[model samples]
Target: MSVMVAVPDSAEGALALTSAIAEARLLGTDVLAVNLGLRPISPEHLMSGETRITILERTHHESHAEVVLHALAEHPETERLVIGVKRRSKVGKALIGSVSQTLLLEADVPILAVKLPH
Candidate 1:
């Protein structure tokens, strides 16, 4: 099985990737980093060492949560899902909704929501 992480074009997403890499290392599994954003995901974003990483890129045609949910369904071997949660006020969260929240509810696998360091 492998770890699946969604790498958005944001610093918070980079933090999620890092956390997923650490988890993969601890579990001795491969990592699948999905980039569904418009911009290219940089190699520098992957700061982990000595781990197998597969990068999957796609257009932002669907919602982020939809893309991740689709990935989870496609990758049966995925141990869990990892994503970043930006600190948002209750109003912000209510107004914007949340991708992490959607995945936490929809994904069949375990979901790890990582937050950026303060």
Candidate 2:
């Protein structure tokens, strides 16, 4: 089955993404990384398993939650969605709303929110 994951443009995001994809691979699932702007320049490592990373160059500025949800809507291959949620204080969450919040509240498909330790 296909699994969609939104990977943000950050090292922490990338690491969390790789971990999620790798785990999904082990579970015998197809992993697709919704990379908005920050596409993987190098081809995905084979040892890491097969993953299709789709980069949206036009969506870097817009809300990534919106971008990935729209992408999932467009792609028939998307079966489920996963995304990382770095721990946030109330003030932080207020200052910059979390994508996890948006996806949890708005996405039509099942979303697996990976909560990162603070």
Q: What does candidate 1's lDDT look like per residue over 1-118, in tens digits?
A: 9999999889878888898998899999989998966787787877678888888776448898998888878889999788998899889988987888888888999888998778
Give the TM-score (vs. native) of candidate 2.
Answer: 0.72
Query: Compared with the true structure, what per-residue lDDT tens digits does model 2 show for residues 4-81?
Result: 777766644565566657766666776777775455523543245355444434353667878887887777666677
Give candidate 1 misplaced runs (Cα > 4 Å). none
List per-candidate RMSD values in Å. 1.4, 3.1
Instruction: Kindly provide the TM-score of model 1 when superposed on the true structure, using C-alpha atoms.
Output: 0.92
Give the local distance difference test score of model 2.
0.67
- TM-scores for all candidates? 0.92, 0.72
In model 2, the worst 10-residue window by lDDT is 40-49
